[model samples]
Target: MINGISIYEILTLTTILFFIGVYGFFTRKNLITILMSIELILNASAINFVIINTYLYPENLQGAIFSVFIIAVAAAETALAVAIIINLYKMITSVEVKGTELMKY
Candidate 1:
């Protein structure tokens, strides 16, 4: 129910969400949290793309298609991340930050 809110407001909100995601990705130490933050950033970009396309070019559906692709990619990314996290947890029994440092050469 945002009355009189212009397209700029929507873009601003998207930018804020994107920055929040960037902050979370930078600040979080846990792997899962980082992955979630990445997803958030992706979602923010997708939303902004869709909104811009819908408002500026109402005839084209390319933005919607791109958003769908983003969703699919996000789903695949989450699945892979979960699998990796589970394997890491099984190996160490703890999914804490710096747990994978041992893998570094």
Candidate 2:
């Protein structure tokens, strides 16, 4: 237990968050909502990494380093995704996922 919270509890919460992200990603039709869901999934994994590291290897920095790397990658992914969405918006004027299937140059 760390700070009165058990690892099981933390893991459970992360699992729930991950499923929520999955659900959001699958159910949402909008591109921005899909991006938000992707962020949520990435965050859930990051949280699991940090939490496990804290409890299992308190003296090591690998978990933290990996978390930072994941964050950096996530940021870059978000930026690129937004840029794509913007360009798609300009082309189609709509951000719906199904509608984008027929996207033209």
Q: After superposition, how far is residue 36 of candidate 2 from its true place, in Å?
A: 0.4
Candidate 1 accuracy as TM-score: 0.90
* Top-lDDT candidate index: 2
Please give each candidate's TM-score.
Answer: 0.90, 0.92
What are the lDDT figures for the candidates, one per model?
0.87, 0.92
- Model 1 clashing residue pairs (backbone): none
Misplaced by over 4 Å in model 2 are: 103-105
Candidate 1: segments with Cα more than 4 A from true spot: 1-3, 103-105
